[model samples]
Target: MVPVLREAPELSLWLLRSPSPDSAAAARLAVRELDDAEVRRAALFVRPADRVQYLSAHIALRRILAATTGCPPESLRLGREPGPLLSPRTSRPVLRHPPVPVHFSLSHSHGLILIGTAASAVGVDVQRTPTIEAVRVVGPALHPAEWRELLALPEPWRPAAFAQLWTRKEAYLKGLGTGLVRRPAMDYLGLGTDADAPPGPPGWIVRDVLVGPHHAAAAALAVAVEPRITLRTLPVACLYDGDAGLPLSAAPLLALRRRGSWTLRWSLLERDPPG
Candidate 1:
């Protein structure tokens, strides 16, 4: 069973891999879990692969959120808060139904989707490591200190190092509710080699997420001190059954338990009896 929602910030991070290309029918069925707006948005994707990814990400997000809130995935109301000058990039995601307050953030890149949940405000970002050429073009836009650190690294090491700093900075920006409106060069989230480098902005905790060698990810929380972060993987096939594209026949039963004062252990069951 999902742990009861709490007042204090307890961070949970879930990583989901997108379904294979041949699972088109199953993808179509999973779209039922999304709202009309999400369905329309998926339709807007010109590439069939893009559409599949968008569907997989949304379905997994709703199912995971539903598990925690005990509400049907389709019943979770999702909307965006208006931003200054009506900029869509600045608009923050808000959930208004079931009256159970929880802060969540979603991010996807390539085949991986990351979702972060917490009692207090939170933000997350994931990125496929960029090529050396791409890194050279965008690396300078990061904080001057970060840029210098990147320059100091060997040529072969720059891509991964740059991705690490980039994800951290983006996570912080999303956490601040400013997105890219706040200049990336303004904050210092460095490669940790510099003894003088500042950790991050005040009143926030930023940490790197281990997504594997091909990708980099990070999460930030709006709290004075860092909280224990729990990481779990959700398999795409578990969202539905076979090629029938039926509704979550084998739901992921995440049994979360507190082993110590701060450790969270997640046991992923093979199948959950229909709730």
Candidate 2:
């Protein structure tokens, strides 16, 4: 399971609903609350089925982000990999906040695409339980030893761990903004693990995050804070309504002990790497 990390000053977390809610009113209600600019911006990528879902998720994100830093909606911008596109209206707020070089990564499964974010270089990823066949098809990211680690895990946790590693690597990719264009093995290994891999792509802090219980996830950021990976679970309702903007305020969020697909996270954890 990707452990959820909350309370990192260097990093923050947000969830984009795979679907807005049971009713269209919930989706539309969330959309109407978004900044007009954010809605128009997301429209550029809207697909036939993506129209409603896209609006609900992105708009929710903009509201939450604006609330977090107390910045006006007009000044904030969402990046392609969930990057921060804050325009600042002018150069002063741009200089003051300097946009913080936020990075984001996303993945979906079982109708949910979990997202995580951080400053500068950051990566986030999500996956539902891939088929047994899919596990065999992961390519070179999993070395012989890593596969051994996966195999060593008990039956219940194996698939979850597989999802974790895959998402962690993918999150690192998103952090690099290279997507799948670059090979993760060539860049990182056991990302959130104690293996002592390189920091991150040029000028980024290398961190990992696990969001859900059955799910695995990793995030890459720019700053090097001793791994204070805090994890929390927010409900689809609260996330879409922009309530997750407050730090460590997910007390009202659901406390999911187990789920088929859960998010996980690994920050620059406080413990020393195993040597």
Candidate 3:
């Protein structure tokens, strides 16, 4: 049976730390769960770390969908045209047909990985806090009104406020699938008067996510109603343990046995900073 979410208008965010033996094991399990094309794409990654990150993110997404759809994890097909979607393979216009009710986005920064899933179209972004000088260099490119407003902020708060604004813009664009191709300058995301509650584009709801003191993250959903997000750290063992009837090979099982218990630290960004 498909498990229903405990909260309405809620999004699920899963975080995974840097690659380790346990993560590697989890990646292998993820590989087993993926379709052949996905496995081929994963194998093409030149860097082992990149491969692990891709696998871990996709694995967590599959687990989430499996729980929601009551489908076997391995049987749930996922594809990336630009954003996450429930499809057999990667292709543009995955949404040209009936829109997939489930939408998701993924972002990774430094060693932290974030995956967000919702019933509506969603996008997420994470960025490391930029140096004050870095912010100054790029600040002018923002919407003129936004830049002017940012300058009025107290000096100490500028960096965080800028980070918040930047991520929100990025998340919104990502949701739109235009990325930087659509001039951000043309859009006004309010960062000047209110850092926590920026004026997002109409029809989209934006929220700043607090990953930690050093990093900033944000999410945008294509719904008027603000989404309540639930964040959790997914351990490698949990992925293997909750295979949802997916077959596992002996090699991955051996790897899991060799690795000791793995733990991840997570911080919830329940609220934005007081404006």
Question: How do the residues 1-275 of candidate 3 rate in per-residue lDDT, one tens digit apiece?
Answer: 99865443767666665455344364445467767876787789887777766776666667766666667668776644653333333222222222346777788776567777787877788887888998899999988778877888887888988888898888887776667666778788774464544455889877776566777888887876545666555555445544452332211110010012212222223322111
**Winner on lDDT (1 vs 3):** 1
Highest TM-score: which candidate?
A: 1
Model 2 agreement with the true structure over 90-200: per-residue lDDT tens digits:
111111243445444444544444555545445666666666656657733565446656666665666666776777666665665556655546654443343544444
Which scores better on TM-score, 1 or 3?
1
User: How well does candidate 3 match the true structure in TM-score terms?
Assistant: 0.70
* For model 2, the run of ten residues with the poorest summed lDDT: 87-96
How many steric clashes does model 3 contain?
0
Instruction: List candidate 3 segments past 4 Å from native.
Output: 1-8, 21-29, 44-46, 80-100, 154-156, 192-199, 241-275
Q: What TM-score would every model get versus the actual structure?
A: 0.82, 0.60, 0.70
Error of 3 at 114 (Å): 1.5
lDDT of 1: 0.74
RMSD of each: 6.1, 10.3, 10.0
Residue 135 shift from truth in candidate 3, angstroms: 2.1
The deviation in Å at residue 67 for candidate 3 is 1.6
